[model samples]
Target: MATIAPSPPAALIDGFGRRISYLRLSVTDRCDLRCRYCMGEAMTFLPRSAVLTLEEMAAIADAFVARGVRRIRLTGGEPLVRRGIGELAARIGRHLATGALDELTLTTNATRLAEHAPALAAAGVRRINVSLDSLDPERFRAITRTGDLGQVLAGIAAARAVGMAVKINMVALKGVNEDEVGAMLRWCVAEGHDLTFIETMPLGVVDEDRTDRYLPLDGVRRDLIERFGLVADAHRTGGPARYLRVPGTATRVGFITPLTENFCDGCNRVRLTASGRLYMCLGHDDRVDLRAAWREGGRDALDAAIDEALALKPRAHGFRIEERDAAPAVARHMSATGG
Candidate 1:
């Protein structure tokens, strides 16, 4: 017999007064593409039994929504790879219809979005972020290892055709695709999609040293300023990206600088892994095993675990370049953490 803790309060406020309103939920750890920066060449995915069932995910999301979560983003090794994800999206849609959830979004590699986009849009998903590094087929194949540029492009088109607001996320690596910053920006703008340039952070394990691949967005921004005369915009999409707009053009660009710039002060989100672990911070290993707690003690136990985990959310992530080189590497990969 175990003691059942009290129900979690309706308000989820951390020690730093950052009200928790956003949730990034990983549906599955399986992926179709092996992006060099995201995962290693050889990867071991969690068994289906180890991952959360759609019902379990819905229950956990409900718990969070009951607390204070308004926005939920489904992530994964690639969320589209998860079977029957449309069902989960529809389940979350019920919450959205009732005003319990403000937004239901997803981040995917867009490999399978062509098939899943219609189903996802019908299920109430209106916003999507596609991870595309290069527009060139050969370069894209090299970066993703096995991704087809044509398929990804079709997927992006499908998502837009289905009326979902599409955003392109590009992880800029020094010698890999940094040279294509201008081209990527131009292509995204031409396609009427906002593009975000992300600074490669120290997450997961890769064959090459992370420092070798690290490319900050400062140089990219300088080039954009010089080339397009881009200026900072006051618009924020409720994420980490700093938005900028090109003068006389409707195109907007964003920079997510997790290493050079830290946005933890305004951090208002927590992540739930596919294995039912709640992570307080992305850069830290602090997590609560909610699956065990839920199986053993039900909702109260899950709430208790979440309460305990929220208390440990660090003020800031220690993911600086020097610390990345010096500190012990994180054991869990980004796929496992739902990056």
Candidate 2:
């Protein structure tokens, strides 16, 4: 019989006294597709040598689990694109069996889920959030820049066929996909998948102006209520989304309004970049270099570094898109910070 280690005491309380229980761990800064809002077309990705090894990433995940982190979400420019991802997932997912981690989820573009869905399911991932901006083939191709819509749609279907719960994450862009959000909602209802609309955040310098692409989710929800008669649903998925269920259907729509409305008061999550840096806030650049800490001593170094990072976690991210051609909140792109 195997022996499970006892869970360690919680040590991730922020200055505001909020307990951090969620971690968005990025396995790679590379992606198969380059979405306009996320990164540039000619992106200069991180060298393979710069990223943390699979073993190191697993160790980091274990450290967080021991420190009262109940949920771990694998994020990325697209995590499925990472090499040996199946092995990495299974390693960290062992926490679920030990009861230290309550849930292990993934956020993906679904472009590679077709080939990796079964492997992910075997690794204890029951749910995934897919980034699907538009239902139209041409529009999707336009949004992703180089993505084939057929491939992604097939991937989503494959994931669902394997009993994986799917949640669609759509970033509301002012003239780009804003008009299609309603249509996407109706399609999500028919497909039996949850939909979430996110405001286009100013994270990095992209092709287009941030102010021009920004679309508030409040207006989107008001429009949704008018057309579909949406009602508030108390469904908590452990992220920063406020949900609303469509009447007479099993589908629930979510809104992630990072700019128009801040969710900092109850922010219970932090991001781990592929390079082993721990970011305390999504909209801020304050981070601790866990790579150096890990190299010096192991989990003890990581725990100490985490304490230093947590103590420095800001009360609120100073995000703003006040005007056109304005610089982003942080110079590092969302891809660098783990989408």
Candidate whose lDDT is highest: 2
* Model 1 agreement with the true structure over 1-339: per-residue lDDT tens digits: 999997657588888888999999999888988888878889999988999899999999998999989999999979988888999999988998898888999999998999999988997899899999998999999988998999999999999999998889999999999889999888877888888999877777676677878887888888899999899898876788899997876778999998888889999899999999999887899899988988899888988898898899999987765534443246677888886
- Cα-based TM-score, every candidate: 0.95, 0.97
Encode model 2's per-residue lDDT on 1-339: one tens digit a residue. 999997665677988999999999999999999899989988998998899999999988888888889999999989999989999989988988989899999999999999999999999999999999998899898999988988988999999998999999999998898889889999999999999999888888888887888888888899999999999899998899999999999899999988889888989999999999999998888899998899898777879999999999999988888887999989998888886
List candidate 1 stretches off by more than 4 Å.
Answer: 1-8, 323-329
Clash pairs, candidate 2, are none
Provide the lDDT at 322 for model 2: 80
lDDT of every predicted structure (CA atoms): 0.88, 0.91
